[model samples]
Target: MDAFYASVELLRYPELRGQPVVIGGGRNATPDTLADGTRRFKRLRDYAGRGVVTTSTYEARALGVFSAMGMMKAAQLAPDAILLPTDFDSYRHYSRLFKEAVATFTTQIENRGIDEIYIDLSDLPGDPAETAARIKQAVRDATALSCSISVAPNKLLAKIGSELDKPDGLTILTAADVPPRIWPLPVRKVNGIGPKATEKLAAIGIETVGDLARADLELLQANFGRTYSAWLVEVAQGVDERPVVVSSEPKSMSRETTFERDLHPRQDRGELSAAFTDLCTRVADDLRRKGYEGRTVGIKLRYNDFSTVTRDLTVPLPTADAAEIRRAATECLKRVPLDRRLRLLGVRVTALLPAGSYIAEPQSVQGELPFAPD
Candidate 1:
């Protein structure tokens, strides 16, 4: 999907297409319909929040807006960008449509997330490029959205290749193209080479895929150890033997939100309480939907200065009741310092088991919220 969340929002308000649009605001950002049927949207300049960008249109991206960036920072970059609240329900509906469309071709699909997937076409009889085109068309026909795709020899290359083009891009990469095509790119472009690894690679004069590919094996081992060094070298050469996994299990479920403004635990108790309860409820709903029960509930708190802390509590039995998860999470919250204003809060459930396998039991939570006044 191209700018997925923002693209979906464009479908709802076509007039905003091609404009710098951002999707991460709260209910207050919802557009108002005037008597003449014109919609008035909130602008980034009008936003004053601790929230982060969820997704942005390419138009917004051109202005330096990107996901996970501070909303205030994005506003400074693209002050006129239209702001809209997120609608996960609609995004999920479109995700189902695109995945179902692709399933018509072959079931060799490995779902990476709501936005990305890996499809194995080696077993399918046909030109892989044509198959890729057909899949792209099917996705657009089904969802009225564009997706960037790449037909590569392996997952690593495919992942990197898919990102080579933007909006509606399709690139075909092969072993012959690794030297000319992939080598010139920065080492940071590789999936597993995250910020820390990139920094380490930079410090060692390995700036590009070509550098990593030609790097000394002994030097890499001395720096990153044999296991990771060997893996890095192989990835630089575009070798990924991992198969496209068709099914996988999740170990945990969680929900978290960054507030539009920092809320003092005591002064903003009502808002904090509402948001905390919402996170617990959503996490419980996720467990029930996925046929799982969790014995552990946890809480995450990020203070105004951006320092984060977490605590978890394990219950006697696994269950998916929202209240039980909330009760456990509240207990965890009691164990964290709340003297400062908070920018974010989260709830998580872990130690999962098949829902029916657990004996259902609800535990009572005593006392008011530790941060709140009764």
Candidate 2:
């Protein structure tokens, strides 16, 4: 999908193309503290108290700014860097276009997110690298956008390989190619490796992938525990065998909102319930739009302290009704102790099946309410 959100914005406003542009915040304000070490950040206008940076353009990246940086700090770095509000619906439409374009090359496409994808070109025509180039060309020809691609035997290296080039790139690596290419890079380059893990690895002088490859597995296991230690070693050695999962199913569907201020349930029941109902409606809309009906309905709450909790229920039948989702969510909420103030609230649906699959057994449940579109 390329620089999806930003690219789509660029297409709409061609004047902003090649300029540093950012998408976040209201009309005239920006966020303040974006980094407190690592990548966690907050916005300036949001300082008192805001939003997260969904995505930023390449020009913004040159100013030590990036997606998720606090809006205020981003303002300081690139104040005049055009600020635009996020339009997720527009981005989703573009996502479908690019995804369909890639499917023309291979059905082994794995949707990474609204912006990225992993296409397995192993069984496609011509050489793998050539096929990668062709896929890149096709995406540009179809969407008027460019993307980076990596072709390897498996996903681990392939995911990493795709990012080696920028904007429009094509990089290829095989099992035999590791030392010169993968070793010198920072451990953070590994997709799953986070700042915490990188810091832990650095404490032991394991900076590069090569260093990790040579480090004692017993020592790594001692520090990182069993699963992560083994995964690190395999990634370091380019031994990933995970296949490209072609059938991209929704793992979960959710909707969340950040408040202007932390709200207490008892103190602000009316406002809170209104927000909750809206969230449930959005989640249900997502479920119906995706042609899925989920049995598990859950609620997620983030407290003022920033701690989070989730409660869920598996119903007897799958549904995509807003009121039904809200009832299940409210029932789940009772299980959670609402002693603290809440900064965010969310509703989720999981355990999904195709909506049509549940049509034959329409059993009615007593005491359950029905949802109507608002």
Q: Pick the candidate with the highest lDDT.
A: 1
What is the C-alpha lDDT profile of model 1 across 200-255, one tens digit per residue? 99999999999999999999999999999999999999999999999877888999
Candidate RMSDs in Å, in order, are: 3.1, 6.2
Runs of candidate 2 exceeding 4 Å displacement: 26-49, 266-271, 337-339, 359-365, 369-374
C-alpha lDDT of all candidate models, in order: 0.92, 0.81
* TM-scores, all models, native as reference: 0.93, 0.86
Cα deviation at 70, candidate 1, in Å, is 1.1
- Kindly provide the TM-score of model 2 when superposed on the true structure, using C-alpha atoms: 0.86
Q: Which residue pairs show backbone clashes in model 2?
A: 31-43, 31-44, 31-71, 31-72, 32-43, 32-44, 32-72, 34-41, 34-70, 46-49
Off by over 4 Å in 1: 359-374
